[model samples]
Target: MKSEETPFEGGPMDGRSLPVLVGPTGNPPKTYRIPVPDDAGGPPTVLVYRRVPRAHSKRLGLPKGWKYEFDPEGKRGGGPRWPWSKPDPAPDATPGGKPDDTHG
Candidate 1:
């Protein structure tokens, strides 16, 4: 398929339309919606959908320090869970020296 054939060529994804893959083949295509947190903070979340290789899923551009997990029954179960809480901060060590990286 041609690159322009994909739905993303129109412009920045509106986070609603289903973007199909342009080329190549793999396991049966699946649809995934990633909820990106709003910079201003509100109830309206940006929902981006992708119908492509699982490896390409990371292109959704999740926020730094945040993470996500795939839900096999996503579309049926509502949607994938998001990283709601901040990740635990690394443990601190003596103030004089660099923090220990060996342990969490």
Candidate 2:
């Protein structure tokens, strides 16, 4: 007898599953399906969907260190506005130059 080449050849995903649609408050959003890894046991992962509304909206329950802004035309202006300012660089680094090692 010959062995199967692929793991999904005769597995649970034998063509009985369907795609799922995910989105926020809007008429048209994104759609995708959950992927099944080759190995049954693996590290966990998460998927996030970002949407830009035409008008002002409430905040979302995003994870820590995650940020989002609403832009009608999706343009990058002025450096960064409130709620999304740039973080300070390392202490040994210059304003626009390379870093300096004094303690090393």
lDDT of each: 0.40, 0.34
After TM-score superposition, the amount by which residue 7's alpha carbon in candidate 2 deviates from its true location, in angstroms, is 32
Q: Write the per-residue lDDT of candidate 1 for residues 1-104, one digit (tens) a residue.
A: 42222232112353223423333632213443556677888865544333432233367853322112334343443345569945444466466667667976
Scored by lDDT, model 1 comes in at 0.40
Cα distance off (Å), candidate 2, residue 84? 14
Q: Candidate 2 on 1-104: residue-level lDDT in tens?
A: 22212111113333232222333531323211234454658854322222223244348643222112222343334444667777556677676785677888
Positional deviation of residue 88's Cα in model 2 after best superposition, in angstroms: 5.7
Residue pairs whose backbone atoms clash in candidate 2: none
Model 1, runs deviating above 4 Å: 1-29, 50-104
Which one wins on lDDT? 1
**Worst ten in a row by lDDT for model 1:** 2-11
* Stretches of candidate 2 exceeding 4 Å from the true structure: 1-39, 54-104
Clashes of each: 0, 0
